[model samples]
Target chain A: MSRQASRLDAKKVNSEFLTLTYGALVTQMLRDFENAEDVNKQLERIGYNMGMRLIEDFLARTSAPRCLEMRETADRIQQAFRIYLNIQPTISNWSPASDEFSLVFDSNPLTEFVELPPDLTNLRYSAILSGCIRGALEMVQLEVQCWFVQDQLKGDNVTELRVKFVRRLEEVIPAGED
Target chain B: MSTYYFVIVGQNDNPIYEKEFSTVNKELRKEDHRHLTQFIAHAALDLVDEHKWKTANMQLKSIDRFNQWFVSAFITASQIRFIIVHDNKNDEGIKNFFNEMYDTYIKNSMNAFYRINTPIKSPMFEKKSEIFGRKYLLS
Candidate 1:
């Protein structure tokens, strides 16, 4: 049991380490560039690139076999987000009136028990989460536009995020005339 | 001896790092483009390839480039590699530099925003690198 406990501790350490480090990096980058807009752009760019690469690592580490289709891929993303980040997002609604689907996180772990620094209250750290979703969707060649429709922290009555599937991204098919 | 270039290569031999510097322990002009520095970095990389085959892990001075440059390598338990190449002017100072660099690198890597194995040439990197170099190396 000691071994199992040790492993759990290690995993927790690693997760916290990643979170702290990423936060510091973003904070420092924003300061260096001296631009909040640029910082957000970097955050998204970084998230997309990271998501593309992390999908491979996540697959390798989990060794859960594979996802057979885009739907499965999306499911896998939801599962990973739940287990790794402790945020449970539910998929719902997606209609012409909304023009986008929603991933409702009843509780946001990154922001849980946490208050944003005074200057950063307006800055959204979870933007990276949106980027990751977009990149992961793109990897399976599913074209989508994702954004935070609502953030509980920002005085929205409902804490929710909506992702819109704009159009199907290019699919890399096998080489064939067919 | 003359100079050293050091880089971090993963299991796939992709360059996670590339830094060139004179062993002379004097700062090059800030205007000096990365090319001149990266030129000698070629040699340091050659040394890394040779060393990886022999050692499972490296310490503070496992690999030294002449009297001018010293290469320090670290491979995370996950097999992510980190390489630090700086002048041997001060080992303690160099160690501290690597620590800060590692902190920044790890954070950047963990960021959902960044891709793995990407060059650390972002504006953030430049800003942090300058701050770190000034604090540890210049002071």
Candidate 2:
């Protein structure tokens, strides 16, 4: 199945349509919302919804076992993005407690065609990416807090997302009451 | 000929996919008997839970039995379960069936339209389930 999945993936996931569609969606959201904060929230909401299901597809394709620790999860997230979205982000800036780290990417496909207006500096164009990460982690019984700290679109050298380990959720086994 | 009933369970004991592969004639197969198959599958969830954490292995073979019927379970890493209720014991074949069903379940879940924990209503899923049931159970 992995062989078939990899073969199919090779023919799939061209970024042109995805990039343009995201661009259009953000533009429409920007127009619909009164402030940059609302627009960023909308983007993150969309990404969170997708992320809930994305983990299933990711697990199905990769059959990845559950990560033993937060550090392992960071590496798995990077690997997953590389395989699915074709982005290679480096993990750095670990907290002394090892509970937080940052994902640094120089070229984000979602931003390749995006240029933010100066007034919209507070708008996080890639908030959806962090939302997706949080949503996917929740499904695996891991609760995390993810947010954008820097954006190249805002003239930063690289895009950076700070991910903090909040707490691990315990799997709630059904009581079979139903 | 053994009759087999299978169910895929998601979180909160929600049954996502269910099927019966029966060699018995429809007219001869009583409605209560058919319902009994499902009830047995439901009753085994507790046993499945008890046995699942005992081993890291996915397949908990022959976890429950009722009268003559036996239940086999395969728990995914995400805690979704594939369960089988059968009158005859064929451990190897049941394992093969669970593995195939796991692949099919994953493919269905990967569909952008399909959610991880919901009833699998796709015709393709039904068709593949039938094919796998025939290949692994009746043979």
Candidate 3:
């Protein structure tokens, strides 16, 4: 049983046209739930579980080097989005301290046909993206807070994901070393 | 976008290998959904048997349909069956994927260290399956 579960990593090799199905799932979940916040929470939880599993597949496929700096990590993440979803998010809006940055997506596959209804103003249609980033980063020993500050589905010009470096897990790096 | 549930059935109608090709772990985890897919796969087994001798070709395009899902079947010379339950249409892609998998199965089933008609444990097999699956089916 466990071996079968482990073999599931094979399925994560592709992510093309996946968001449409994911969108269907999200829409289904929206109908099931009365509150948009709860829907967001559900989507986040789903993305978290997906991230925890997908990181292994990502690591195996990409063989990306261990990132010593978060800046490099952001670049690698951009590469990942490009590879998996065929979207390259521009890394911008860096904080002065360099502990935070925003990933600006000019085109998001998830929101291609998604339109937020006026009734569900609080729904983050793609909260799963944030949860996925958080969970994938956690596997690499990074404790980062990630969320969507702007979404195209929510009438934003573009989709922007904000990631904040909280603290590194199981590490004791001295300050000023970046 | 489509979801494919692929399974390889060995002798005695036993499942030797299985995979669900979709965005992994992203689907809403309702317990009944998977059970329904499984049941559809099982229900199509008798249909596969009924159609096995109808065609001379190894590939049996699609044998059954359960609502939105379609069951496609391919059989080996030794009667090992590969079944895929999917939500959309892509006959060419599924045929290409099965051909690729059949090649790997030939190599794996011939291995001295590997047992016949049992679970395939080779990393190379899984790697090629994923690569070809993405190439032919999910592209």
Top TM-score: which candidate number? 2
Candidate 1 local lDDT, A78-155, one digit each (tens): 776865676678777657554466788877655432334345555666778888888876775667787787886565
Colliding pairs, model 2: none
Model 1 Cα displacement at B100 (Å)? 34
Candidate 2 chain A lDDT trough over 10 residues, lowest sum: A1-10
TM-score of each: 0.45, 0.53, 0.49
DockQ, prediction 1: 0.03
Candidate 3 lDDT by residue in tens digits, A61-135: 667789998899899888878756768999999999888999999988776534455676788888988998888
TM-score of chain B of each: 0.60, 0.95, 0.92
Per-residue error (Å), model 2, residue A173? 5.7
Please give the range of 10 consecutive residues that has the lowest summed lDDT in model 2 chain B.
B107-116
What does the lDDT read for residue B64 in candidate 3? 95
lDDT of 2: 0.85
Which of the two candidates, 1 or 2, achieves a greater TM-score against the reference?
2
Candidate No. with top DockQ = 1
Candidate 2 Cα misplacement greater than 4 A, ranges: A1-3, A173-178, B1-139
Q: Comparing 2 and 3 by TM-score, which wins?
A: 2
lDDT tens digits, residues B42-62, model 1? Answer: 455556566666766534344
Model 2 lDDT per residue over B1-139, tens place: 6798899999789999889888778787655467888999999999999998899899999998999889999999899988899999889988998999888877666443355688888776789889988898888
Instruction: Give candidate 3 regions above 4 Å deviation.
Output: A1-17, A171-178, B1-139
Candidate that beats the other on lDDT, 1 or 3, i.e. the better one:
3
